[model samples]
Target: MTDANTTLPKTNSSPWTSRPFHRQYLMRQANNLFDFFEAPSLNPKGGFFELDDEGKALSAANSTRQVHGTTRMVHSFAIGSLIGRPGSGEMVDHGMDYIWNKHRDAKHGGYVWGLDDNGVTDGTKQAYGHAFVMLAASSAKLVGHPLADKMLADVTEVIERRFWDEKVGAVREEFANDWSQITTYRGQNSNMHLTEALMAAYEATGEKAYLTKAERIAELIIAKHAVPLGHRVAEHFDENWVLDKQYLGSEMFRPSGVTPGHALEWARLLMQLWILGDKRLSWMTDAARNLFRQAIELGWDTQHGGFFYTLDWDNKPIMREKLWWPVAEAIGAAAFLSAYDRDDYFQIWYRKLWDHAENHVIDHARGGWLSELTEDLKPTSRLFTGKPDIYHALQACLIPLYPATGSLTAAIIEAEHTVKQHH
Candidate 1:
């Protein structure tokens, strides 16, 4: 964080306002490039739900591709949330297919945790898994996709079919094939994420059902998830919102104030709804602030510009390595702030984030972002950053110098060197 002021560039321009229109659209073309796969999900996991011809699995491997998958989902969803507008019918058709193909539990209609390397369904309905649907559906509507409204309805079916819990009005964290609550592993992280997703949907549609879901999740956060002793959130919980150690396994819950990654994501999603007069989104914004501030106080590296991979409950640096996702989430949160906040405090973090990441993650010499980096903004591992996943062209920019206006596809055609998994 030492370079916050020194490395950052002074811009007199407005935060919301971008560059020249033609150039802006050119960069945006890169954003649109991922619609082929990176942006849309005909089914949930990878949205494509099978291995590509090269034998790359359609779904992200949590461990096999740990470095990229860690935060790729957020970036993917952020991009997809904006481009994948679908209808209720499309949402259901697509969701059910994925549930059946990649995510579905064999015994029930609910989705599986995610797919495996063989592209097989080892079914479990993780809370994070379902949140993907909610977030995508909400963001799709914002971009006027023909299927957006129906996609919202399709996700509603998922909630009614599997996510909704009548007694709690909040989603239980996980479930068996039939959507029965996983009693042994009770909790609220999923609920919190679900809240974040539902908030996005609520803002996009103004649907009372979504708001009801958000409010209930908020109640669950305040009641059970929020640390009574501190401002952070417990990563796991019991059915009654009691602390549950067993569910956390050998990996003791780090008990940080709140994960900056999740907190910033919540802030962005909620802010989308805020301008429309939904005050509930404020919880997301406020919670993000608390968690981010806590990170600064407890987890930030005074010598390094980015955040640590993990921080302990009392703000101790349990894992001090810098990971890529936090930077991306921070960028997103700051982008929201630049657009909405009057003070512009977020730019401090946002600027540091870019400077740090570009130094490490962005491989200017080789191309694309690097897979990982060290505490000193150097590579810690091999250049296994990521497979060349696609994205909407609107967000993709080869560089600020050359954007994808009329030639994103053409750039791919001309690109002789590409980073990909060798089958």
Candidate 2:
């Protein structure tokens, strides 16, 4: 086995922790990721780029604009701008224009699901997309975009009136075009993203309401759902918020069984929530640690070094193919847990996960990252083709640079401002 202290920043035999050297290392990796995606990911018309297998821009004519994709680009570049990356604001503006002009439903209140050259390909109003819009707007607000606050308000109002279920602590799943017909299905996937967006919104606006809503959702996922289910979050639910274990709604979004990626992600988010809020939530800390532990134990491929995409209820690998996002989430989870727990296992996992990313996931030639790879680590496009967005990978690379309290963008922004003041 490798000596864990060899990778530690300064200490000869201590586990890795956040020091100046560690910060510099993380910054370098983050910049490498940011620089690669900043230019290539942008579409010439406006919004972000989606490339073909050859690393060329996917033809605009055939390309359809997805609400989540565009919003993710906006959020990613806005983070870049927060960290003083040049031209990132322009990219943010590009995505904002697309959000306002193409994605927004003029007749209806909320954003549409997809758009193409003909416009409005999939007109469904989804909480998943709206959550990302909130995230994008929150990041833009931090960067002082002209339309950010207005956009944030518009989305916030729509989410409150349409998506937020007062009786239930989480957002609803999907709605019809006029926002009249709501689905019977409830989903933790959308709510998970909603929890993430609410945290960002709280940080951007200091609205206690947003934080309160976030905490409720976190409790639903972490306490009600995951903690009782052996740390496996139930992805689908009925109208009454009952678990739908047999549900197989959407192949990508609502697949049956548990997604280890979301489990690891919630673990990371739970810690951030604990730190951001009262910091007295001992249950939150325990839940976070347990979730991380269970996820690593169940989702990690014992034969291979990467995480399985999905695990059956029996803890068997349902989807054997490894994707980039789970490892990215695992990296973020390990980074924060290592800092919080000072556990040597997390430190070991941190090093191992980064090594796996550097060796297998990173697209050194194409710029961004390979979205998926086979179990043997060969490149595969079955799940995702080319690089889509930088949100997960960027956060994984940057979040380790700061203490585990706030949004990655906000933390980086504050750290930069502190350094400038000191200088």
Error of 1 at 384 (Å): 9.1
TM-score of each: 0.66, 0.94
lDDT of each: 0.49, 0.83
Q: What is the lDDT of residue 135 in candidate 1?
A: 63
Which regions of candidate 1 fall more than 4 Å away from where they truly are? 1-107, 116-120, 137-154, 166-169, 180-183, 222-230, 244-258, 280-286, 365-368, 380-423
Count of clashes, each model: 35, 1
For model 1, how does the per-residue alpha-carbon lDDT over 229-346 read when each residue is reduced to its tens digit?
3445556666665665333342212333335455544444345444433454466456545555554555567776667655556566655556555555565556555555555466
Model 2, residue 301: distance off in Å is 0.7
lDDT of 2 by residue, 1-423 (tens): 322342445444354444577667667777877776777767766566676655566765557888999999899888888877888888899999999888888888899998776777899999999999999999999999998998999999999999999887888889888887767998998998988899999999999998899899988877998999988888888899998878876657777889989999998889888988979677888888888888888887767678888888888888888988999998898888887886566787887888889888887776667888888888897777777667888888888877677788778777877888999
CA shift of 263, model 2, Å: 0.8
> Whose lDDT is greatest here?
2
- Cα RMSD of predicted structure 1: 9.6
lDDT of 2: 0.83
Superposed on all Cα atoms, model 2 deviates from the true structure by an RMSD in Å of 2.5
